[model samples]
Target: MAKSNQTKSKEETGASRGRKGDRADEIVTAAFEEFTVKGYAGTRLEDVAARAKVSKGLPYLYFKTKEELFKAVVRSVLTPAFDEMRDLMLASDLPSEDFLKGPFLAFLQDLVKSRRMLIARLLISEGHKHPELTRFYYDHVVSKGIAALRAFIDRGVERGELKPTGLHDFPQLLVAPALMAVIWRSLFEAHAHLDTDEFLKTHINLVADAITTGNRGHETS
Candidate 1:
């Protein structure tokens, strides 16, 4: 004589005062803004809900808590970007130095113009205080990116296309330029100027000269 649980769930979803007009995505976007601007500890669910134009309780129905929303915001901002990086890394047949240092740097350039840099700054500024979020970002973005570079470096060394250096074993060294750009742009843009494209190219040439036995000259596109 009781309504089916599935039907009850449907009814509840429909009856939810905040569910009808609210979407998880909108909340995540708003949370991205809040988390990057006010930071994870400072952002509130009600503020996110207000920004998303939903009921004050709407974000909870989707995120359960601010920490969950913070992770979601990070994922939303980063997942697609890195998924593109994964695709680019796999499909790139350019020289290893060119591939790893070229489009990858370009991707970081684009990210600086987006909210991703803010999120990166947010993580760096607060990561020590939030180990969980720190681990999530490291595992998902940092580790994955480093692994890809390591594999690419190994392949290049084996093929004799790139000089075999200890660099392959240390992937963090590979992307340091990109991370430095992010930090410099975020924290010191006014005090100093950085030409990101030029910096990336110069960095590549320096690394290439150190790690390549080839006769290839600087190939900036």
Candidate 2:
């Protein structure tokens, strides 16, 4: 009977995990839609539940509050991008101007495709009201991204492929254009009539040109 009880407990554990997974998926999906359309401040748990077709109370089983749900959505979107950038940085045998360009280009493409611009705008708009949520985003997403970029730029400088800019400025050089691109596409493009891909390609070229050393006989303007 003890052995049978152990087997039953294991089955129950498996069942609980499956239920938790399902619930988490539901909440995330719901949060994505609601947050995408309404912004974080405008979204409600009931709206998420309605969108997910789950009981309103069910979201609490996965996330304690709407802020937590929003953070989860942001994490779900940005974590993979960070990991990809980290991997690209790691796999480079030598740091060169073009070496950094590939991962940044790929990341920019993915960022544009993901409509994360809308999510970012929402975060910026609502972040002031929910300082904790904004702080969490900084701690988890932006700070880590800046650190990663700084490391890559430092590597390039050490390899003599890039100029010896201060590390503090290195992240700004690498990240500012990408941030500007997102803002332009999401916020100003309607008025500015900008083509995002074209803008991204041009921006990438400009950044690559700026970072590469002339001694390497690489083209720089």
Candidate 3:
């Protein structure tokens, strides 16, 4: 009888934890929406709680400050996707061009489809004022991504698959178009439609051609 009672207690505890976890996710999702619509300085924890439809003190129970909440939003919305891309780059032995055209292109599409661009806009517009937040993002996310791209580029060059260019030192060249797409979508999409899919495909082909030795202007099929 005691063993059965203990088993029931453990099951109840697990369910309690699951409920709390779901509530935390709800708060994070609400926070992301608030931050997207209102810049960081304009957003308040009370407003986040209201948006979350939770008690006024509930957000405080989860995140002590606005900064913590903002970081949580970043982790929830951005970190996992970047982590997946980094892992994919690390594990794949495919040709550099193939990797860029396939997995990297997929990642850029996912980035555009998600709320990540709004987060990027936030970082670009307000990062100087919030040095701590900027550093946190760079240290936790940007640096890791850049390092992964650099490793892949270096490996390709060493194996004679890529040209002996400066790309290994500056991997930003690989994803520059995605950033451009963010800016264009934010500022110019109302005036003119930008076909993002074709844009990215062209970018991938151009980059593949540039990095592939003696393969200038060759289109990727």
Index of the highest-TM-score prediction: 3
C-alpha RMSD of each candidate structure in angstroms: 5.2, 3.7, 3.5
- Which scores greater on TM-score, model 1 or model 3? 3
Report the lDDT tens digits of candidate 3 across residue range 1-221: 99999999999999999989988899999999998899898889889889889988999988999999999988988899899999999888677777888988988977875677799888888888999999989888899999998998887777677888888788888888888888888889999999887898898888888787643232335
**RMSD of model 2, in Å?**
3.7
Clashing pairs in 3: none
Off by over 4 Å in 1: 1-22, 215-221
Tell me the lDDT of model 2 at 50. 88
Candidate 1 per-residue C-alpha lDDT over 1-221 given as tens digits, one digit per residue, 9 for 90 to 100: 25698898878888775654448878898998888779889999999989989899989987897888887876888877887887777667777766656787677667666767788888889889999988988888888888887887787777677887899789678668877888888889899999877887787778877887673343345
How well does each candidate superpose onto the true structure, as a TM-score?
Answer: 0.83, 0.86, 0.91
Superior candidate under TM-score, 2 versus 3: 3
lDDT per residue for candidate 2 within 16-82, as digits (tens), equals: 9998898888789779888989888789998999898899898887789988888888788667667
What TM-score quantifies how close candidate 3 is to the native fold?
0.91
Task: Quote the positional error of residue 6 for candidate 3 in Å.
Answer: 2.7
Winner on lDDT between 1 and 3 is 3
* Sequence-dependent TM-score of model 2: 0.86
User: How well does candidate 2 score on lDDT at residue 18?
Assistant: 97
